[model samples]
Target: MEIVVAADASEKGLGAAIMHRFPNGRDKAITHASRAHTSAEKKYSQIEKEALSLIFAVKKFHRMIHGRKFTLLTDHQPLSIFGCKKGVPVHSANRLQRWAIILFTYDLPMQYRSSTNFGCADALSRLIANRQPPTEDAVIASVDAEVRRLFIDALRSLPLTAEKI
Candidate 1:
């Protein structure tokens, strides 16, 4: 038996799948995950987009794949570098380098599977709707606004004193 993870990115979104492959070549999909990219993410280069999909999938399926051996499948051939024995490549973008560090924790080997052979993940990526889930930045911005409001309210209630004590 073997664990197989496949990830793909499209102009619309990112998609990934986790599956179990039996010795006889039979495979069963455990789960399929996908999310629309943020505005900032959509501006990423093609390589970065693909790398982001891999990282997103790895994190989404962390519980099932962590601490276990697995095979990472991607249509992006350049991502195979993540599994190279020499380690992270120096020429990779800063974002990819950071993602590589995160990927290093998982004991998985990367493999390049052509898109035609990677239909499940490929379809999912393109099928994603335009809707986007609430982001951490949104939550943090709300919190910051609330704090600033409270600070202003508190200041308004206090009287200013220039007199020396």
Candidate 2:
């Protein structure tokens, strides 16, 4: 399997996308958006939130693929270091180290992309970041439900053989 992943981050929050190629030539996609980091904006500390968010997105992809080879794309360049030995520079808090460890468990190829080109992932991230719990609850709920339905459909459609049983 070949996969393309993308992530976007801003003052509001983080968003990620994963596109995969199956044996049948069809593609699979997964996206996630979550709250931004609100902690102090110290030198390296600012990346802590982004790193954690990236880890979350990667893990979500792993759950979907079950150890398939995948490529990761991100608007945040720091994440491209997962393939590096020394690892990327991060805060003294060791956030990068923690993220790198988790990343090693998967077969990931990293790449960088501009936010403008990230499309769906960028939109989802911004939507989640700007969401207002009171007014946007219904809209968010609808989108989440739709995504879940799509995921289930995709899983059910996966090629599985009963003869192996």
Q: Which candidate comes out best when scored by lDDT?
A: 1
- True lDDT of residue 99, candidate 1: 91
TM-score of each: 0.79, 0.60
lDDT of 2 by residue, 1-165 (tens): 577665655556666777776889654674554554444522334456556656767766667645776666666675667755566566545667877888777777776767666676666556663434545788899999999999989977878756655
**Candidate no. 1 TM-score:** 0.79
Residue 101 miss distance in model 2 (angstroms): 0.7
* Pairs in steric clash, model 1: none
Task: Give Cα distance to truth, residue 103, candidate 1, Å.
Answer: 0.8
Candidate 1: residue 23 Cα off by (Å): 1.4
lDDT of each: 0.90, 0.65
